[model samples]
Target: MNNLTPERRKGRKYDQVLEGARQAFLQDGFDGAGVDDIARNAGVSKATLYSYFPDKRLLFIEIARLECKRQGDEAKSIMPQNLPVRDMLSFIATRMVSFFNSSLSLSIFRLCVAEAERFPDLAQEFYRNGPLMAQTKLGAYLREATERGELNVEHPEFAANQFAELCKAGIFARLAFGVDKRISPQESSFVAAEAVEMFLARYGVTQD
Candidate 1:
């Protein structure tokens, strides 16, 4: 379980600690980041940092949660709802692929998996905030589109998961496994386009 409580989060240095810890984790990974370095980066003393986060794992989990929330909020704010189904799906696929290909996202995923056994809640929190959140949002849109006669999806949640996997088809595995250091724009675009097409082929409404 996470050690961070609502009361602890109310501390003035909470955000500062989190930001500093995020940088350290990004640079040195979970095991490599030290409490002293994190405190120094945040311009706070070790005691101040420890007061907010009793365990380093709790700090990492909180960072992941907040980052996921930020990304999810940004996606919701900018995603256009008035576009045609194909266009909307294309937009979603592109965004998903880009996020999946990012170094920070990959690192978070790797860390979650690596710590799953010892810290199962960490992986659960990541899933709830990341993949499950995306799926739920996409499912709602798909359901609305289906009601508007723009799509034929019977199971929007399942379809959303499928489309997400399709968007990850080529670049995700390669990057996650170190087969590729970076995903070129062309590769990401191609994957997104293909995912949109394949998804539309299955669920798009036919017009005579």
Candidate 2:
């Protein structure tokens, strides 16, 4: 089912096809999901689906890219400026962990793991759209924060990756494997706080 609601089930033709493809891929996996099933579910013919996507791999990449953009926009929208360093970091980390805990995100992670060997380009696309893009934005933020004397990060890229990793610790792996489908807000907050604390410990100007 992939947990897509009926409300999300209806949309414009292009979105309908993308949503159907997402459901098909998640439910049946990349290799197992048939284009016929995807087209039928989308209320489009195979020809229409092909016209839009050309190939299943391209469809999957588009889905991944769209999701990544959505996540990035969400996190960016909530980002606070002129706040305390810890507060800003906490806000960012919480949003990130929340997205990582989502079913759609987990499904994408699973797809990359399951199909990467057979479809290396697909995996690379996901990586670039998801984690690599996030790291780039986070690194830019870190650089700006450093200039304001909120921290002392010499390597913003490395620090961004470290912060993201710390926020995902103890949660992302478990969620991806189905050990936990939903993480409580309390737990997410705790992890976000810990990530901020550790990051500040390493980079704060006052830290010994």
Candidate 3:
């Protein structure tokens, strides 16, 4: 008799719609995918899809957000820093770059950008999920390292942004242009090691 309990099933419908919508966008890209296709895939009617999402663009954007959130969750689960902060940072950055290089991450970004103007809402939502989450979470980690006397940071948020830029330097841009086939093993190590050096020079303080 409890309406709001798990047995009540308040968000199952929306969850199903989002799952189907994400799968469709990933498989077909936003432009190539259709609302009816998503509806049918979810076993829901177009009317139901409309009720769940105001429009196809919104649905695609939501899917992008969901995927970004899932990645954020994974990143947060990384082991906390006990070593030199630079080493920890390198570990996280290397893992992050490899994660982004995956085909699925590249495809969602391409899909979002290709239709960004047509659906500014989608673009904005994607920003919240990707850049915003990445910076905030990584910044928190850096802030913690500073409190532990492992690194000295003036602004953890800015530190996080710079660290990410270093790791991603020219990598995503190259991906955007289809100039490379993902960051190779050698390249990833080079980037990670160099970024660690850069981060330490900027944030680590030498003993007096």
Candidate 4:
């Protein structure tokens, strides 16, 4: 899904470089993707490519950041401010699970895991733009829910992180290892339901 608007992603040559880099990284993996190949595929001069991204790692990191931000934006757009706590949590969890289960997301995650030790900064950049941003946004939502007396969360940040983890529960490891990466709607529903239940059990307030 092309989440980026053409107007916002203007500049024909700039877009070409990013598109070329994305294809190269996805097809060849980080280690195998070359700047020269990216330039050739992009149909841009080496100078043009370098003008946008100083190094290959920077290019790859930017791509990862863009994709992660896109996913987050999509998820955020659907987060309802008026929904009940359980319903909102369920919605967020389901959206996150869908994003995480995608082939593109899985590929980027695998690359981050494999290269994190050598390129810690790149991994940090990925985390900041992806999971960390999600957690922060979710924390704000949880805080709002608490203010509305829907939940008993004392630490919204911690609760947010835990909810996201609960959503990933039995699926992330399988995805990382390339085992049963595909998730059916039924499976996603099950995970989202369980995650919401567990999260509400911990933080939801009940009227006696």
Candidate 5:
């Protein structure tokens, strides 16, 4: 027997329901779906669905989180330690820009920003789960560089943030204004060089 609260039980039920809802949401945009349709598609009761989430907003955001986690993993693929940090970060920045425009990602960004006033937590959660996660990974590399005395980073995490922010300026800014552009390979190389230059300037072993 499960001892979870009604809300929690609904949350669990959503685990199953969400798999279906995710398929539906991806196949159909957010505005095109219905609560009953999602519940029906999930093989759950309307009451059960409502018990966990009073509205579609909460449920959609959770789905967005799941989607963001997938994006985080993809971003991680760009940060292989076998490669140079500048090469890796430049690859990461371009990938980040490209990913923000992914159908689900762009939608999630819009949803979170649109509801920022009503739900600040969602915005924070998106950041923590997405870019913040990327920064932590990047910070690990910076920490390694610091130990080697290649980059004199006082705070690896902060260094990671600065690096990521500088690199993402192109793609992230576009997401904010409903613009869509795919980054090219040539562009990635250019941005990667500049980002590497910037990171070196901020925390190089010795500034020239």
Candidate 6:
């Protein structure tokens, strides 16, 4: 769902270029990753690389979009639907925290923010594919839980956003700004548990 033309996307080297670009962007960030390096890493000539992805920005954004989709799908596949509501919420929160603190995630967020003004479309695409997609998925789960009498959420969308922000609480900003080098498992667990508690306090169904 990127800007790649149909003919360009049909070429055999398309996936090769994308994989190479993914590695380069992850290691060097958007501005630091050179086209020559990307082509070399892909084992393709510059002409072939350019034929598939004419713009580096499009290549970067496409990688981010694909990564987001892959993560979303993985989460859906691994998350147990039969778990108790509290356990399920905790699982979601813990996973969210872990992903937020990942190096790849941090790099993508920094790149999107740094180049947002110059490449507004890049940032917008990342947002839609990343945060917006996550929120939508969470909202759907909240609605399902509410139907099952597990949560008393009136507005699933707002509650989903709140839960996501809560997952990020203390750790995300620190990591994003380079204030904290890394988040320990203990810290990550604490944040995830606390997020679940706070969210349940607000939205969980209370027995009379």
For lDDT, the strongest prediction is 1
| Model 4 CA lDDT for position 141 | 88
Model 1: which ten-residue window has the lowest total lDDT?
1-10
| Model 1 score (lDDT) | 0.85
Residues 1-208, candidate 2: write the lDDT tens digits.
1221112223358888998987876566555578998998788999888877777866766676677667657655756667887777887898788878766677677777877776666567667767888899889989998998878999999999999999898998888777876789899989989998898889988845
TM-score of 6: 0.74
Candidate 2, TM-score vs. the true structure?
0.70
| Model 6 alpha-carbon drift over 4 Å, by segment | 1-59
What is candidate 1's lDDT per residue for 32-143, written digit by digit as tens? 6889989988999999999899888778777777777787778678878699998999999999998888766777798789877876776777788789989999999999
Query: All candidates: CA RMSD in angstroms?
Result: 3.5, 7.2, 6.6, 6.6, 5.7, 3.7
The order by descending TM-score is 1, 6, 4, 2, 3, 5
What lDDT does model 3 reach? 0.73
Model 3 over residues 1-208: C-alpha lDDT tens digits?
1221123123568888887887776656666578887887888888888876776865665667677778667756756656666667777788767755655567667866886776565556567767788789878888887887878997999988898888887687886667875678888888778888888898887867
| TM-score computed on alpha carbons, candidate 3 | 0.66
Q: Which portions of model 3 miss their true places by more than 4 Å?
A: 1-63, 79-81
**Model 1 residue 84 distance off true place after TM-score fit, in angstroms:** 0.8
Off by over 4 Å in 5: 1-59, 71-79, 181-193, 205-208
- What candidate 2 gets wrong by more than 4 Å, as runs, is 1-12, 20-62, 72-79
lDDT of each: 0.85, 0.78, 0.73, 0.78, 0.68, 0.83
What is the model-wide C-alpha lDDT for candidate 5? 0.68
Query: How many Å off is the CA of 126 in candidate 3?
Result: 2.3
CA error at residue 119 for candidate 1, angstroms: 1.6
Error of 6 at 64 (Å): 2.0
Tell me the deviation in Å of residue 148 in model 2: 2.0
Q: Which ten residues in a row have the lowest lDDT in candidate 4?
A: 1-10
Better of 3 and 6 by lDDT: 6
